[model samples]
Target: MRMNPTFIVMMKCSEEAGVQNPVFQRLYICLGALKKGWKEGCRRILGLDGCFIKGFHTGQLLTAIGVDPNNQMYLVAYALVESECKDTWC
Candidate 1:
């Protein structure tokens, strides 16, 4: 088993829709502790899943998970994307 690597990289992007409207384009959040834990204590396989969101602003909840030695799911990263497009995946 490997431990998750530590990191501290976060990104947020947006664009102005109108004179007073700002639309969220993309967001990425990853923690160093989570990464280190994953690398040190988690298995090699990584699971990815998401679902369509329903509300005022529609989007998807994307997540990355890994299995640990005890076969437990470990959360690695998460994001809220407008859609499951190729660009978003990358």
Candidate 2:
């Protein structure tokens, strides 16, 4: 955040029934550089997708992508959430 004032980072946590403290539920990140680059050089069209994450951390990985003027893929943003559901997407 210090490096990029426009950067955005968010974290969500929830308390379990018997947990003593809040547990991490989700995280979202969008770098300032990436966002600026997308807005200035990428096409208006955007594509969103998600996939399940395996191993130690079990969740979903969501991504937003766009196309550049050169017709190449340009990653806009991404997030890690507990699940791929309507609520999570929002």
Candidate 3:
């Protein structure tokens, strides 16, 4: 955030039984450069999608994409969430 004032990074945590500290629940990120580029040169249309991760750390990968002038897919933002549901989407 210090490097880029427009950069955004948010994290959510929850308390669990027998845990001294809060457990990480979700994470969202948006790069300043990508956001600026999308707003300046990319189309207004946006595509949102998600996929499940299959490794040890299972979670959902959500992404927001945009179309550039050349009709190429441009990544705008993304988030790592526990699951794909109404709560996470918001």
What is candidate 2's lDDT per residue for 8-36, written digit by digit as tens?
Answer: 98888997899899988999999889999
Q: How close to the true structure is residue 90 of candidate 3, measured as C-alpha lDDT?
A: 63
Candidate 3 lDDT tens digits, 5-90: 99999898998899899978799999999999999999999999999998888999999999999999999999999998888766
- For every model shown, the clashing-pair count is 18, 0, 0
Error of 2 at 83 (Å): 0.8
Model 2 ranges with Cα > 4 A deviation: none
Models sorted by lDDT, best on top: 3, 2, 1
Best by lDDT: 3
lDDT value, residue 27 of candidate 2: 92
- Considering every candidate listed, which one attains the maximal TM-score? 3
Q: With candidate 2 superimposed using the best TM-score fit, by how many Å does residue 13's alpha carbon deviate from the native? A: 1.4
Model 1's TM-score against the true structure? 0.78
Clashing pairs in model 2, backbone N/Cα/C closer than 3 A: none
Q: Which 10 residues in a row give candidate 3 its minimum summed lDDT?
A: 81-90
lDDT of 3: 0.93
Candidate 3 versus the native: TM-score?
A: 0.89
Ranking by TM-score: 3, 2, 1
Q: Which structure is stronger by lDDT: 1 or 3?
A: 3
TM-score to true structure, per model: 0.78, 0.86, 0.89
